[model samples]
Target: MFVKICSKSELPEGGVFRFDPETAEKAIVVCNEGGEYYAIGDKCSHGNWSLAEGLLENCHLECVLHGSSFNLKTGWPDKRPATKPVKVFTVKVEGDDILVDIESGVLLEKPDA
Candidate 1:
């Protein structure tokens, strides 16, 4: 099921938001990249650091602990030290609200276009 994380205005372009649900196993990091919204696992695959605390540039979230960069769209590590990709989630924007599907479980790979 889709849960409302925040409003679209609450997260500006290039901004990152972190959400940890009591019923979920992993936290989620929601990003706003030039109006588009993307969600991924908050933990870095390499260092287990929070992706929300990382820098967001060109849709890539860099891990502050080790500089591992993960693409928000695909959850693939663009930079090294991280060979594995993080989990990605389905995001949908409804009116001024931003919603994410964390109940469906994690997505190891990017969904087919």
Candidate 2:
């Protein structure tokens, strides 16, 4: 199932928006690169830093703490210091509301292109 995160207007081009659910166990970071949207795990795999607070360059999101860059599409570490891949969430835009599916209880696999 998808949860409403925020409005589409709130996320601009090359912008990052952190979405928190009712529980503190999970958080999602959504990125607006151009007109498309991509959602990924908010926390960095290698550090305690939030990826949403990091720099966004194209599809790569750089963690300021360790300077690790993760691909928004696949959640793979494109740079050093991060060998493990983060979770990539599915995003859906419904009119003005932006929804995200955590894909919880699902098996880890290659992201869809």
lDDT scores of the candidates, listed in order: 0.86, 0.81
- Which candidate leads in TM-score? 1
Off by over 4 Å in 2: 22-25, 104-113
Clashes per prediction? 0, 0
lDDT digits (tens) for residues 52-91 of candidate 1: 8988998899999888899887788876899788888999
Candidate 1, residue 2: CA error in Å?
0.4
User: Candidate 2 on 24-86: residue-level lDDT in tens?
Assistant: 347788998878898888878888778888878978888989898988877888767887788
Clashing pairs for predicted structure model 1, backbone only: none
Query: TM-score for model 2?
Result: 0.87
Query: What is the model-wide C-alpha lDDT for candidate 1?
Result: 0.86
TM-score of each: 0.89, 0.87
